[model samples]
Target chain A: MSTPLLSQGTPPVVRKKISDPLPVRILLIGLTLLFFIGFVFLPLGLVFAQAFQKGWDFYLEAIREPYTIEAVKLTLTTVAIVVPLNAFFGVTAAWAITKFSFPGKAALKTLLDLPFAVSPVIAGLIFVLLLGSRTPFGSWLGEQGIKIIFSTPGIIIATLFVTFPFVARELIPLMEAQGRDEEEAALTLGAKGWQIFGKITLPNIRWGLLYGMILCSARAIGEFGAVSVVSGHIRGQTNTIPLHVEILYSEYNFTASFAVASLLVFLALTTVIVKAVMENRFQKNSSQH
Target chain B: MGIELQNITKKFTDYTALDNISLNIASGELIALLGPSGCGKTTLLRIIAGLESADSGKIILEGKDTTNLPPREKNVGFVFQHYALFRRLNVYENVAFGLKVLPRSKRPSKSEIKDRVEHLLKLVQMEWALKRYPSQLSGGQRQRVALARALAVNPRVLLLDEPFSALDAKVRQELRRWLRKLHDEIHVTSIFVTHDQEEALELADRIVVINKGKIEQQGTPQEVYDHPANAFVYNFLGNVNVFHGRVHEGMVTLGGHSVDAPDELKNSAEKTSQTFVRPHEIGISKIRSEGNDLEGTIREIRLLGGQIGLNIECEGFDQPIDAEIPRELYLNLQLKKGDRVFVTFNKVKVFACDYEI
Candidate 1:
């Protein structure tokens, strides 16, 4: 047998990346980093800097204000209530869309996404028009001793409208990707509807649900335009955190406004971090589970 | 008693997936629904398992009408093609899912459930990977766990939908053998769907061939293979050489050659008929023998492992006839392409021209 000596015959070859050339890759990466720095980091850093500009005492005083605490409580309450409601709605909607084939399914999916495309202000207007005191349904509800407008319910409703699609939209594609075969298997194994859902469906969609919940919470907490529309700006009564922050800024209390804004920034940052951690777990769970 | 599907018809919009399909499965018999893709074999199995609703029919299990019953009430173990093990659950948990899902009044105790799951896992020979999640396991392992999961319920009948079709070829063969052995030990009436003729022929005690929402034939594997009911069954069961010819003078003529027709075809109204013969049934000779049926020249010789395949081109035949010869015979003959040979068909199935494959 003759030895080929292939290594000696061939010259060293330089591997070239066709997907992205060196200059283009570097330029694209640099531009992305610069965009995040200038828009995200700068704004976030400025909020904290300006909040503490008046020193720790002023920042503490602003946070300790009774109205500030009220707004914080209201935002938390809205998130606590809205997140679960929307999550439930999202799960049922996603389940219906993925599990069954029915007429008008596509239309139902489209309608679920309507709130997403509508401006936050328009969402608030839609709710207000349907539920306000001047409307028949609103008056009927008022006759039943319910207050929807200029109240916590109204603010919560607006926030819910704005954040509703986050959970369902994220979950639908995930549920669809994870087909109904497992559920069918469970059912044929003598599993009831609830058992199949809890044992098979819920475990498969937990990470997606949690991711959607965090995002929904963040959106609900940070909702400004819609809440501002229906809140009526009642200082400690109807004002959510975002509306309260606007009130503080308009009153020239920049430090107080930024201090309130800094809370939202922390929440957004935490959401991103949680999403990053959850994303890795999500992929791992989906692949290995 | 086993299962009896009475006129089970299912339609998806205008497309009839199962057109009044009726079947009788014997107790403790392992059967297979064999057909090509979209041939309603899977639909038949799903209908029997209560995973799919039939438009109009009766599903009788153990002599009781189970029509319109939901899957939860069916008491049947269904293994899907994709395995469909709970992705989040470990192998042990997945196998135990059926036992756990049983009503609390009827559910086995925890220790009993554990013992059952372990026994089933061992039955499928997947006990070593009990703690591994489905995604962490290979396709073959997942299917084993899926089988164990289905058996966990101890249902009267077991239904599998192309249980090993998703696996690679080698794994699919191994699993088919494993499934046959498992069915033997359990003695549970089992029905599985498959498009592979070998899998159905090897694993099934009875083969039900479905086509276009109807049962084409149902009998022992050998029965369907040796004497296929129609052109579809003849072609779908295995490789067969189709000879399209005319019926004249009590014989079917191919090119310039002729063979005696079947008893029923005497003076048949049909002007044309197709004669089907298996590859191995055709005898090859270097010269024209006394009972030779056709004169042909070898177009191609293929080495098919222990058997040698020859594609013989004959006059007036659109496609070359495939003849399989034993390796020993092929070696002794030293046959090559373009060799003149006479073929003697030992057995032939004659069908109407309209039923040509």
Candidate 2:
């Protein structure tokens, strides 16, 4: 942190009596590059390589298939439902935790980060145990003619559990750093509580909120394990793009699976670019303070 | 009618922030709550502004009991220490925010708000920065905008918590003058809290000195400075030398010298007292003469800008006594380090013996 790297554009090279050897720095950089290319870059390149292996007409036919199109719609709908709910939960959680004091504050904060630590599969299983038809509430839901487990609602709920922490985690630190003085100033100026949040707090945290929402949306779209366990693979009803990819690959339809995966690849690249821009602005804003 | 506080006390678990305190501010009078850090001055200001609520107390504003009212209904303007200008809003919007947030029935039209905001910006001399955000302005300019924004609602009272302390020394001085002129024009009963004695003395019509969660004294600047109520008031207002002594028959005996003590000390239950004497009040002579109750060697002579500071090491005191002399008087005396000099007090402040403890 004392190095200029974190706060500003330029990172200074400090030369003391002892320093890292030239070979060691090069070795560190080279190893990271090798690992990235081997595990990450090559797989991504193969997705595009195989997507076009058949030709443009075949690629278009694969994506335009009814099941694939249905999967795309389901994924977009899931993201639309999950993202806003997650965002509302994130903003409220951040506001409550950062803006006030309560007895169980420490415990609540630790629980907010639980989703990040819990495995995606385990997160899906928690909801299954709570709401699946085998349990009493789940059985009651069934007797009431409601189908929660192995349905769209069940998949959406499981996805919610896994992608819950992104927006709140991003907002908590940012809002906490920008303390309550400005809000108090607004109150003195006769602004109502909601007005203060809408005008003052929102503008301050807009970029960070956007960053978290993007990450949350991306996580909701590409999630495979949790949605798989909960969805029950009801084709054309609950199969998301990631689950559809699994189905196509399992059937040995290599061109279609890679074609679907290339969409994910493009989404991932956009996410990386957006994350970089948001992270840059966050750093600059923090430093300016 | 103005503002009144009755037995306002605040305790933070174990430490008391404000002891049972009561004060009243007259209408249209500008006062200052002046003290060192953590002396409960800012706390008192916040409680008055309704940002803080005092436990078991009443805040009467213009003959209305408003202790439980929120800041929005309290109708008091607070300018924070570090000008809390909304970073996202431009100067014009920041100033118009108060007017626009008013209830629709009481709110003015768009053109009226525009004219008022423009007028306020012109009043604060920040018209050129109307289109600029707070981040783009310097500390002084942001503070000016904060002042303009605070005054936009035309509240009955204005409270500033160390308004100029965040700026640099030169800018702070300039802003003090600017604020005084502004207060004169608007005359909205204002109370500012500051720790700097000079700022309190120069800007405030009445200065309230607080320490250890209690009001030590409150009066006009001249009254507090010239006739301090007690030893704490004397020392807190300015630099002074304290001589520990005992009083007998209207005289105080200390450090091989006896001086006329205040008349209250003669018949007081406590025989011991301390004499407070300002450095400038105690004149210095090159040679021993009549009325020279103390003598010391000039340990150091420092020219501090327009004035000369002399540090004298005298017997019976472990620390050097600091004295200031005008540059003109210093040059005439041609004083030097290691020079022997005798000191005499022109006036002395006497207080009960427990003051030192």
Candidate 3:
């Protein structure tokens, strides 16, 4: 009788208080894994597998091609230029919006979000219509012998427009949550405006700023539609990595295209790893309290 | 250093945050600006600190007209309620921030800064956590670090905005005593804002009670607590039972009892008034008393450690009358709920209905 009572009591006690039935849990988990493999992991794995199909030598040769190297350089340059500018703009914008009250604030906030709402293709087209030789300003610019459309500067501008909102969007909520207390404390401590910004505000938002810059860099590097529209597909000139891959794939250079695409995939993987490390560090720091 | 404000006024949009207000602070006085939330006590403090500028005012600090000076130039130390210690910096760096940010000509040397920071940390009794970040410390420890950071500048005036309000009751009490002792030793002219009357009474050398952007009264703790200026001050300072009645011929009648009014209300015209009596000022007895006694049945009894509270309900009264008695007296009476008792007012203040609370 005691053994029977123990078995009846143990079964109910061992069941989890908040969980679905076993079969339903299994089904949900299986569906998630299936979607991940089919949509994400499979394509990432295939890029590398196809790139190295011939051998390491062939893959290295494809990557060392002149156009591929130029594409890599152009992508890096765009990222280097875009990330710092965006970071600066993002910090100032977030600071101004969160810390001060002024007229036109709501309008300014909505204008900042315009890039996120407008299509990248439309953004590229708008720049073209404003700067192309057909318009008066464009004609004046052309008369001055500064060709903007269908050039490298146009490519940079288009990429800049497409990736404009990444850093600011990441920072606004973080800064707003932080409030103005520390800055005010610093001010009352006889610290000047620049000192308060450098010693207090900047340090407080460093992690958010880094995260924003990383995101901006990633988008700037991978931006294709806007850059393509402005690039004019000038081989060894305005062709970024993504545009280069398109050109290579269209010319039936599958191995070369895969090799070039692998570089982007590698950068993305590195970003994810860095993000994971930062998140772990952040959580550990918070939990230490 | 002593500080003086001359007719300070501030308005936000159409709402007046602070009306024309004037105050004077003697050197080495720890004054508490006591008020409810949104009473503009904080606005006045901020104006003095130069964190906010009053629309029309002159701020005089140490006999200098510093109304137009910025916060950094004002040389005031402000401790925020949330203990706004720099989160990324450890305790040492946070304490040294003010010193390090000084102008090149006045900045301390490296060794001097370290010594000062260490001394401040020890002064706050948080030297053990010098290397810990703000997130690593408890709320009480964070506040101590914040105090050290604020004091590092050695400003003429120190302003605290509800400094200990974020801590728990036990910690708050401990910190209050510690802060009082610290102020006595350092002798900085400090002003703190608080809505807690008990805190103001316990901590401040002088209490300034503010209401609706105006100064209600300013006095020593005992003076304000013993004699509130008006109905608002009396009601705000402590819990009191209000008895609506009529005053005529130097006597105020409440329910079935009439007591002689205070001298100030004696010669006035007959008018309806509300008599305020503190719970402890009412006497409770099992038998009827000789002078102005109202008989009622005990509706409830509460044990409050040292004192026993009885709620008495009498005829012609809409609310239960609260009476607090000593434990010994309550034990001698042997009263329980539904027992008949007599309650008499020992002290009362009468105010006409026209005065708003």
Candidate 4:
């Protein structure tokens, strides 16, 4: 409601507006839109369009192929194994770094960021060098009849390396900011270490953990370079969705390649939607505090 | 329970947080560890609570050695400065957390826990917030819940770390009174750390002044306030005006006036000394009543609710001298800025210049 005295007694004062001029504002917005369309939206749209160029029957047939089905299963299995292991590692690493003081703390922090800094292909190669059948440890493992490189385990390891920092990076700052106050309070109240972590620390960082898991799973599903190096292109056995797409494309199977690529695009879109929802919930929860 | 610390010391890298110190706190006594930031007051409280370990010391609680006990085994309730309530749990669950975390054999039944939580919440006057999360509550309310949660385990001693510092001025005052009342009702051996001298004075039965990892003094609030042990304690407890003067026989000459020095300094050799006087200990007059009174012009006048504070500029003193008098007395004197007035020291404390703060 307007104040009657101010409305009747005086004219509104002119205030200096803080904004860019019209043309500059329009130009910046126009450039951002053009970049998004060219670099992001168009490629995503082209995947689905090209996948369905022939017909629904052809698209369905390509998706139903044995190799394609096996690729989907392998991808799901990789995510299923990688995400939980990484999540466990993330929570433990975050808890150790944030809650305790130890020698080489700075070095440990730098090592955590190693996954993000090193190339995924190089990570795959490092594992190969250490675990390949030619090395002493690899030959020892070979004597034990356990194959790691160029197998499902190798694919899992590569994905684990690349997505290692997600959950930990998300939770380190969150837990650090939350501090050890609550845990100390719990301990003073006669709660054990696990009780404090389960009843206090876990719940406090739940949203952040979920957010990191989602990002990890998304990367695990669509990982290309590292998984490619380790999988050995063993058709239905070792080929994941991205690797399968590459194989199909290089073999001149255009329709099948696009169809498989479209699935990844769909998965990426779903991840984006879930991430947006999680972000909204996280903001709401944090703002309430 | 009673707490005793023998030769407690703590260090962080090169900085010593708590020097070798010893103290005894009687059961059911409300003690305030008062100090400036980084003076090791919080460290002492944490050590007693078993949240921190002294480098070499023995902690005796209720006549039992508890130096190596973990916080869980120490049976001390701690309320953090920020409240530290579980962000995800509602008030009821937060209060029930301690009891719920007890061993299965020792834990109370469901109905018993519910009754206890409800009673504790009511004790803190937060029963109506049973279903509300900590995020929905005010700072004072969160602190109340934190206290309730701490009390759920029925600890023998309660430790509060700057409990009221996070709240606003009005809320801090209100909660200070509330905490005092609660301590009276429960009669638990409670120790709270605070940097606010007024809070310490108003809430603690006894105040222990700490500075640079050493105990300066410990006494009842009135005793410490009236008779400080040293220069640091004198300057910390309240605002005071300092007079740089010399003690030559039994009298100390300050500006143009001379007053009898303290007995300890009076018998010492002739040397430079510093005289300390609280704001309310100085008197102002329109005319020089005593032959030893010093004259100065009022440089600033500040009305402090029930009292009037005047900053007087004397000829020899580099800094203006502060004097506070009753509002009624100010009205009678009709004092204002630029008025020339005579000032007299009502009560003075003398310390040798070598004892620097």
Which candidate leads in DockQ?
Answer: 4
TM-score of chain B of each: 0.96, 0.95, 0.96, 0.97
Higher-scoring candidate on DockQ, 1 or 4: 4
Clashes of 4: 0
What's the true lDDT of residue B43 in model 4?
90
For model 4, what is the alpha-carbon lDDT of residue B247?
A: 88
Model 1 scores a TM of 0.94
> TM-score order of candidates, best first?
4, 1, 3, 2
Off by over 4 Å in 1: A1-18, A143-145, B291-293, B354-357
Write the number of the candidate with greater DockQ, choosing between 1 and 3: 1
**Cα RMSD (Å) per model?**
5.7, 5.0, 6.9, 5.2
Off by over 4 Å in 2: A1-25, A54-57, A282-289, B248-250, B267-271, B291-293, B355-357
Indicate whether candidate 3 or candidate 4 has the larger TM-score. Answer: 4
User: Per-residue lDDT of B1-357 in model 4, one digit per residue for the tens?
Assistant: 498889999999979999998999999999999999999999998998988899998898888898999889988889999998888899999999999999999999999999999999888888888999988787888888999999999887888999989887777887788889889999989999999999999999999999999999999999999989988999999899988889889899887678898888878888888889999999999998878789899999998889999999988787899999999999999888899999888899988887534
Candidate 2 collision pairs:
none
Cα error, residue B339 of model 4, in Å, equals 0.5
lDDT of 2 at A245: 91
Model 4 lDDT tens row, A1-289: 1111111112349999899999999999999999999999998889888899998999999999999999999999999999999999999999999999899977897799998898888988888888889999999999999998889999999999999999999999988988998888888888888888889999889999999999999999999988888889999999999999999999998988999899999999999999999999987876666
lDDT of 3 by residue, A66-137 (tens): 988998999999888888988999999989999998999888888888988988888889888988879898
* Candidate 4 chain A lowest-lDDT run of ten: A1-10
Candidate 2 residues B269-295, lDDT tens each? 547787788877867777778854588
What local lDDT does model 3 show for residue A262?
A: 96
Clashes of each: 1, 0, 0, 0
Q: Against the true structure, what is each candidate's TM-score?
A: 0.94, 0.93, 0.94, 0.95
For candidate 1 chain A, the 10 contiguous residues with the lowest summed lDDT are A1-10
